[model samples]
Target chain A: DAGVTQSPTHLIKTRGQQVTLRCSPKSGHDTVSWYQQALGQGPQFIFQYYEEEERQRGNFPDRFSGHQFPNYSSELNVNALLLGDSALYLCASSFASQPGNEKLFFGSGTQLSVL
Target chain B: AQTVTQSQPEMSVQEAETVTLSCTYDTSESDYYLFWYKQPPSRQMILVIRQEAYKQQNATENRFSVNFQKAAKSFSLKISDSQLGDAAMYFCAYKGRYGNKLVFGAGTILRVKS
Candidate 1:
């Protein structure tokens, strides 16, 4: 079965520009979560989407938003990006039914370079 | 809020030897889950092992195992007979019983020298 897949493995943007990252959930999974991993740091939660709605979000600012399609694919949009936004954006997928027990399947992640 | 910490920034081990990575977490919830994820140079985060709070028995997967001390809020991963492929950044993660988000540690880089 196919695992989680993300688009544009790498991206480059300017401080005032916006970028969109796409993710396709693993087969048989519905819940999608986005994370940002800065250089040499662990990933920080961005937000989570289930049933086409954002169920929870992290401490990120409003500039970060996401959308989950009915098919379980998701997109992360960052507006007015800053240099600090230069990081690896990881997308993970898991089944919402077994939230606590299911293991999150992660994509290779898109490396965002903000100048 | 839940937080995970990995104090070791980097660790090295000879091939075929063993290495342990330490992790500690802070959480108010009684029931939660802990995980160890390995991110190689390819940047894909792969689950190494996991432990459920209520379970007394430690969790083990192949050559990887976890020492979970719920009372002390400590979780450590031990990799046996380390191989070159094991060289990567190992991250400690935590998840609450009610929430779906995972809190992660800064990560420890493991280097296996042949």
Candidate 2:
């Protein structure tokens, strides 16, 4: 079974530039969530998408937004990025809505560097 | 709001020895889940083990086990008979009963000396 997959394993952009990171959830999974992991830090929840609608969001600002396609793939978009936006963008997927199923299989993550 | 904390930034243990990584969380909800995820240099977040808050007997998976004190809001991971492959960054995560979003701690890096 293919696990969660993310695109553009690494990215570099200048301040004020916009970036969109993609994710394909694991087979048999329908929920997709995005996280940000700064260097030497743990992953922080950005938001979660279920049934093609955003279900929950974290403390992130409006500059961070995401979408889930009908096929269960997800895209995280950051507008007018700041240097602090530079971090590893992680994508995680779960099989169901069950609380126990949310251990979440994570992707290798897209490392975004804002210079 | 929920939060998870890992007090230790780094730890080391000799090969074949054992070590424990500590974690604590803050949540008002009565039911939730705790997880230990291992991220090696390859950067894949692999699930090491998990514990459900309602289970009082604790959760054990092979050499990896957790001490879950729900009343105290503390969950700790103990890895027995560690190996070189166990050298990695370990993270503790939390999720409330209703949603799928996870709250993660700062993470602890484990070094295994041969």
Candidate 3:
């Protein structure tokens, strides 16, 4: 059983540039949620995708967007990035229709550094 | 809005000893879930333990146990017989009954001294 997987272990982008991160949900899971973890800080929720639609979003600005494919994989896109965007982008997968006891499975995360 | 807070920025414990990490969350929903995730140097967010608000009994997993105080919105994690592998950043997270997103705390770093 493969767990959640994310692409681009690390990335570097300049201010005003855009970056895209990818995630493959864990097997048997259909919901994918994105998070940002600043240095030395816990991860903050970005958004969650279910049934190819965003079901919940955090306080993030409109510059951040996401997409969930029919296969349950997801992508996080950040546009007009700033230095504050330098953080670890994490992807977690869970079964949205399951009971609340079903825990989330997270990927190793992509380390993004904005110049 | 749900939020989590970890008061201890850093904590240390001798190997084979025990260590406790404190966490408190704010939420209005009576049905929800609380979790403690460990992020090691590898950067993988690993689920350590979890508690359901409906269950009054605290949750425990192997050497990891949680003191879940739903009335007080407190969820403290206790690691028994700590080992070097237990050294990592511990995070407290919460999710509402209808939401899939997790709100996390600032995290507490744990160092195991051999």
**Local error of candidate 1 at B79, Å?**
0.6
What are the TM values for chain B, all candidates?
A: 0.99, 0.98, 0.98
**Weakest ten-residue segment in model 3 chain A by summed lDDT:** A95-104
The DockQ scores of all candidates, in the order shown, are: 0.87, 0.75, 0.80
Which of the CAPRI classes, incorrect, acceptable, medium or high, describes model 2? medium
Which digits, one per residue and each the tens of the lDDT, describe model 2 over residues B1-111? 898999999999999999999999999998888899999988989999988787798899999999898888999999999999999999999987676688899999999
Model 2 lDDT at residue B84: 98
| True-vs-predicted CA distance for residue A84, candidate 3, Å | 0.9
Candidate 3, residue A108: Cα displacement in angstroms equals 0.4
Task: Report the first chain's TM-score for all candidates.
Answer: 0.98, 0.96, 0.97
**Candidate 1, A71: how far from true, in Å?**
0.9
Docking verdict class for candidate 1: high
Per-candidate Cα lDDT values, in order, are: 0.96, 0.92, 0.93
Error of 2 at A57 (Å): 1.0
Query: What's the CA error at residue B99 for candidate 1, in Å?
Result: 0.8
Q: After superposition, how far is residue A45 of candidate 3 from its true place, in Å?
A: 0.7
TM-score per prediction, in order, is 0.99, 0.97, 0.97
Write one digit per residue (lDDT tens) for candidate 1, span B27-96.
Answer: 9999999999999999999999989999999999999999999999999999999999999999999999
